[model samples]
Target: MAETTAETTDVASQYSAQVASDLEQNLKEQERLSAEIEALQAQLAALQHNHSVLTNIQQALGTSAAAAVSAAESVTKVPAPRKKTATKAAASRRTKSQKPATATAKRAGKKTAKASQTQSAAQSAAPKLVELVRAHLSAQSEPRSAAEIAAALEQEQPERGIKTTVVRSTLEALVAKNQAQRTKQGSSVFYTSTDTAEPAADGDQSEQPSA
Candidate 1:
């Protein structure tokens, strides 16, 4: 019975030692697991911070891009200064082009007015010239040629510059109006007032001397 008791005590001591070793190994494993968890947490926190920074950078880039687009759109909406200057230049050129035509039209109008005035003056003087010619012819006792009538008119009125052709035309006009009579002697023509002259035959060719 004493031997059995000693064996039982030895068995109990071995079991207690085995139990202590197992407890110590379990504690070490727990410590190692806790250290691993701390490292993993630190890595996770760093990743989250990096993600936040990246997100902020992306947002800033997006805002900058939007601003750039808006600026470009605004620039496109406004017209360029050069285009305005070109439009002004074209308008100025058109004005300059029109100025010459306006000036030419004014000059043409002035010329036409001057011509009308000259024609009116000539018409007004024609009747007085005819009357002067008729009076000179009536004062003569003999028929006078156009040259003699012109010379006499110039001598009577020094201010008058009577031409032979004008005197001839006036005499012809007077003959047409039955205010004067014309005679042709060879190549010379003579004019006399109708009141003081008699009509001659068609075949008669005679020269009369001036009185």
Candidate 2:
């Protein structure tokens, strides 16, 4: 009887120990799962807050873009200012104001044309400087200095305003044309006319009748 009672006590203690160990393991698992749930809840709360902020920014941007488009449309839809109508009195006044300037310009142009014509006629009437220079050189029997020629011409025509520089330039032009000869003697320059004509060609000489 005592032996049967000791076996029953040992089996009861073993069952109780196993039940206590199972309870401890269940508490640890529950703690770990609770911690993971808290971390996941915190991450989910952060993501929701970020999503709310992004939604607000998107709404603000859309409102701003819509407002800008409305403002642009309003500006483009505004009417332009109307031009002033030309009344008969205003037209007459403008014509009167412009007529004097137009008439003045026309008179000025006419006066300029007349003056130019008068100057041209006077120049045409006068002998050319080159002809005068050649005539003076040809009239001289010997080579004449530019100063003497200029002085004689000035004396002959006091109103002509003959300049020595102009005479010298004319002499040089004649020399270039081979119609005058230039000679230098001891720093003094003189010019003489070339009255000799070019020699006739051989064909011309052959065509000429013999005396």
Candidate 3:
């Protein structure tokens, strides 16, 4: 009876020890899972906060860009006060009558030379005016009157300040150069153009043939 009692006691003690060990292992596993869940929650909160901050920053940048674009559009659409501008075209050069050497023949001086250079602008015809007159005369198939040539030059060079005198002088110079012929009847003058003809009869003195 004593021996049976001792055996029974030993078996019960061994079973109790095994159960306690299993319970300890289960508690340790539960603790590990709880810590892992807490870390995950913390990470999720941080991610949500970061996403919100990034979204706000993007919205602010978009608003600023829209404002800048609106400002640029307004600037382009609005007209500024206009500035008045004056033309200096007439002052750029002297008139045709301002260039010649009439006073130098009467009285020669430094002042006279300076005056001559500025005033005697008429003595030498403008190269541009001469060329314009020649081109017009050459293009026409028939003799054009002085008035006709002046009117044509007016259309051709509205910029050079064309006048009747400039055209008349240019035609006369052309006659002198033998590039053209001049015909005068009563008070009317007309120009007849020619091409590569036997060189002028005495080129230097090739003035308009006396009527």
Candidate 4:
């Protein structure tokens, strides 16, 4: 009977110890679960704060973009002043009204310049008759008559069609200028270069008796 009582007490103590050990293990597990839940809740709070910051940033960016667009539109949509438009119209009308006169002046100036150039070209192309007569008389070795001078001129320059009267008039002009000496022989007037004539003022011994 004593052995049976000892076995019963041993069994009861073992059961109590096992129950206390299980209770301690359960409490440790509960503490671990609570720490895990707290950690998760902290992470959620941080994520919510980050989300709020991002949302605010996004909203600010959207507002700034909208303001920029509005400013650009306002700048592009501004209307020109009425007074400036009127002034531009007046300037356009003035230019239009002056166009005809400006064109006319330009045309007149061109015509005048062309006429002056043509006159200069014509004068340059046609040498003076006095110069031709002097050249002829200077080339002669002996005295020549006006008719002979005219014939020589016609032979040299067939385009001139020079006449004896024109040659006579040019010879008279050269004699008047002391560039030639005139001699009358038997009613026929002859000319010689002044270089061969006796040096005298006006070089005129006109109408010598036939000799």
Off by over 4 Å in 3: 1-127, 196-211
- Candidate 3 worst ten-residue window by lDDT: 91-100
Clashes of each: 0, 0, 8, 0
Among these predictions, the greatest TM-score belongs to 4
Q: Deviation in angstroms for 52 in model 1?
A: 1.2
Which residue window of length 10 is worst by lDDT in model 2?
Answer: 195-204
After the best TM-score superposition of candidate 3, give how far the Cα of residue 35 lies from its true spot, in angstroms: 99
- lDDT at residue 173 of model 2 (Cα atoms): 73
Instruction: For candidate 4, write residues 23-80 as lDDT tens digits.
Output: 9799758755654565456457757865775576556556555655564455445455
Per-residue CA lDDT of candidate 3, range 65-139, in tens? 565556445444544435432123222222211222223322333444465465447435555667878888878
Candidate 1 residue-wise lDDT at 51 = 78
The lDDT for every candidate, in the order shown, is 0.72, 0.71, 0.63, 0.72
What clash pairs does model 3 have? 98-119, 98-121, 99-120, 99-121, 99-122, 100-120, 100-121, 100-122
Candidate 1 lDDT trough over 10 residues, lowest sum: 198-207
- Model 1 earns a TM-score of 0.36
